[model samples]
Target: MSKIALFGPTALELFGHTVHAPLQRRAITSERAAEFTPSKRVLDHVHSTFPFLSRPAHITVFDRKHRRQKYARCHLGTPALLNFDFLHVGDGILAPPPEVALVQAMRGRSVIQAAAQGSALCASYSLHADSPTIIQREPIATRASLEMVTRSCSSIPGCKTVRNALPWILPHAASPREIALGLVLFLPVRLGGYGLPRPTLNFPIPTGKHPGNLADRRYYVADLCWPHAHLIVEYDSDAFHLTSDQHYHDIVKRTTLESMGYHVITVSRRQLNDPSEMDKVAACIAKALQKEWRFRVRDFPTRQTQLWTILGLAPNR
Candidate 1:
């Protein structure tokens, strides 16, 4: 049996040799080692088992100059090597020529930066690997809902006239209603009076009379015309509801909107698991519509205007 004698000056080297020698010899040729150091397969195995290694790591090894000079000159804080493997392409090697080591370190830093940015982007868009490219491409419930809404809208008694007249009438309607219609029509899921199994409604109501007033506005604006009749739906998650301030703010906003005639309906994190929440929300909306229209026809009043003011409007007044 041929035995290999692997020697290193430090504990890290000794450990590396003991753990990596076999895999390095098997995967990489001695000739290849002359040009570029071979990566140990064992490192790949370890990284796969511990996915956390994808995180940034700062490592320093003694320079080859110190190794050759027999400790004649020792430098502190000067890295001999910096090993980083963001792609998990085996254990990285950065030896000699501080410039090379610096370059490798920067590359590693860039990988971490890119990863953090990618994570932020994915989180912001609620992107998922399994999401469909198009509404019709989605699973049965989603496809059915969209088809039903489109078919129903097209088949309405005077749909063509309504669609043709929409461009003109839309501009005259309240900004909130216009925004709500746009959001519903363009949303990934079907919404608005759609008699589908699971329907969602979104309100993209406008805020502020001027740009400056837009700052720090409420999360949502309600349509006061049919306050209790209109449902304000929210998609909640641990991330959004994490802080006490956030929770309190949401509560206050919901209460204010409710006071103005809107019925705020919250969808819990777990409720999204069952598709029936869609139908439940829709039913609640239908029932609310049966009540009297509380929103004033003339114009939406300020917060100080009581509901009584609208109710007292005389037929000719």
Candidate 2:
């Protein structure tokens, strides 16, 4: 078992697929390649159980040549060595840290796709570490991580778009819908989203001047909040917020938010799912924002975006 560091999609899937699953199989092994070698029994067992694994395991040697690459060095963080016979190609191999693997996987993808994937990954798991790649780690650092992947992306030949989209990905998103709402609101209007100012997810705002102690305080946690704009957007999914009690609570919450001088906007699954309807909804949001927005944040145009603009990524607003 020669230790090696595996990365890319396979590593991301391996590291995160079962982070909280009941049957976690990932295990730590020898820190150095010279210290470990797979036994015959281990190899046989892995071969036998390979078919039943959630995903096929693939491993590769992390050679010195790779370490010199800028992206490789910037993206690859602390790696953990593991033993799973199927993942071993020839001998001792290790895997890149989860963050490293994710950045490696983002290579060659479109900006929209990469941003969506990165933000979704953030929502699904914690990817932050004290590693140099990330600064000011998010609260959910226990769930997913972030690092200099954005900077690394910028240095890559075709990753300018990915680099520009980096600021849009949020580590605080709690669900896929929330991530989508962020994309729809921050992605340039040409991309079919509203191009509104980026907002905070699951933002808590106090309802009263002194909302009791922290434990007893009343808060209206908006799905998305633009505090400066004094606006909140709530994705009212039928599956979760359609109950009578939830509905009543929502009515009261909206009233309270309005009383607090915050404009409340409710979005539904139906409108988000349809292009024409989504556009209308976005228009309504634009109107609201126009009324209150003293300043707005739009995607900063990058070289890739300038080229995209010329190529018709979206018409100038």
Candidate 3:
């Protein structure tokens, strides 16, 4: 039988054990001197074996019935070490050595590291296959996984606004699958539909000559171009309008392009949801193209007065 040590009050009560006479005398003697004085070799062994327990506030030694006495602590003790392979810890399971009890004690509070939490712990156990496996397989309950899943979900555009409302909307969704379903159904309708054209979605608008300008910095390059009109169409989604910085930058770019005789049309998320909006936008583009083509054909002024404003130059005849 493995020798078990009972540390705290609860451990002693459960195991029906008491502190060893010699260890208790040592504790009393150390307390009288107002300092602990365990042998250097014992202290060194403890420091090497269980690093976290080295400077704990208080320590005790307890003997289990029919078992040798082992060390305990007022602050930290694992259920495995307390009752000699009998009492299970957080998940109410007994684990074995080299699977060392000290390791379990240190990580008892962390649900992710607990054996009962699932395959993650199982994988860790497999890696240390030579170590003794904990006998009891109780599941450790923790909110960490749920929090991580929620954080990832919130990073998406429409989902950002609906994160707080998720629990109320779907209380049963503790796992990612249920949360994903809820997000799919709730987000699109809640934040409004995806209005932009899927084909041109996220296409970049390239600034022709001065690519280094701030106005062109954030824009992406699209394959399609209306070179004659210098027009660029950007299909905007909620994601595009996420931050004030992005929104302001987009406005500046649009103004700069328009000033350079380029007609820039931004199809926002809301406008895209309307079926007739695309037709209206298309008509505007056609008119702009016709105007540019007509000017080229008639040999009229190719540059507009807006170019002077855009380039910060004085208008000349």
Candidate 4:
């Protein structure tokens, strides 16, 4: 048997999928993998149960008591404070708790990458690197959970970055695109933020009755809303074109919001792809909020490019 090995992205990935459903970790292919690694029997059982684990480029081992020069790292602080957990992957792998794993994964990542991933962690979705890339429904972790972990692991790598990102992570993000949209809009200007105020995600407001519904619902939820500004931004996806019912429902919601004296802006993938169009949306937001539209940072253009590049909005990067 090898010593208990595994941490970092592997652990984050492990807990991430587990948040949705139990999954197995990839096997360690060596004898000297660690001081006390998961036994082959445990690995075999997990592989037989879940045969498809991601094979990382390198193996990672974590020592709760000591550190090694190459593969293993000394655990940060205490296990109790870190809230370390384990998975069935050979029964000895260290699967850091969702919150801790999330912050640890942020080590050396750029602000946008860290913030985007942090938001996704708190979101009711799971983003994957492979096909079907995003799973939307269950929230794997939350800002408050991450905050608790970071507070205890303050000296750990990436904890500060995660702490800086907490204020921007909203709750109940419905889709990957929504997460991207929110970050691009609300992150601080220093981090490629558009200087927009924080808006509640899927915020519900009383809009009185609408004829489009059988229930004559008196409230409608806005995709991204600034209550004080009375403005809402909705991402209009292609689904509306294919689903008449959804389209009609959205139309009614927009009409209701508009009738209630609120300014509404509908953003689409097409508009997002067009640089000038996004600027126009930002302008609309500024006008609604009654704020001057200006970039305070000296290297605003460079930071903006870096932000989009990290967010994957840069096509040529």
Worst 10 residues of 4 by lDDT: 56-65
Clashes of each: 2, 23, 5, 7
**What is the TM-score of each predicted model, taking all chains together?**
0.27, 0.61, 0.25, 0.77
- Model 2 ranges with Cα > 4 A deviation: 1-6, 14-54, 63-95, 124-161, 209-217, 239-241, 291-317
lDDT of each: 0.29, 0.52, 0.32, 0.65
What range of 10 consecutive residues in model 3 has the weakest lDDT sum?
17-26
Q: Write the per-residue lDDT of candidate 1 for residues 93-114, one digit (tens) a residue.
A: 3222211222222232322222
Q: For residues 31-136, write the lDDT of model 3, one tens digit per residue.
A: 2322222333443444354333334312323222212213323232322233223333212112222112222232323221121122211111121122333222
Q: Where does the lowest 10-residue lDDT sum fall in candidate 1?
A: 1-10
Report the lDDT tens digits of candidate 2 across residue range 79-109.
Answer: 3323231243223434444444455666776
Ranking by TM-score: 4, 2, 1, 3
Residue pairs in candidate 3 whose N, alpha carbon or C atoms collide under 3 angstroms: 94-135, 95-134, 195-272, 195-273, 204-220
Per-residue CA lDDT of candidate 4, range 62-143, in tens? 3443443333343433333323433444444435456766666788876577677777666776655345556665776777
In model 3, how large is the Cα lDDT of residue 18? 12
Worst 10 residues of 2 by lDDT: 70-79
- Which regions of candidate 1 deviate over 4 angstroms? 1-229, 239-241, 276-279, 290-317
C-alpha positional error of residue 106 in candidate 3 after TM-score superposition, expressed in Å: 59
lDDT of 3: 0.32
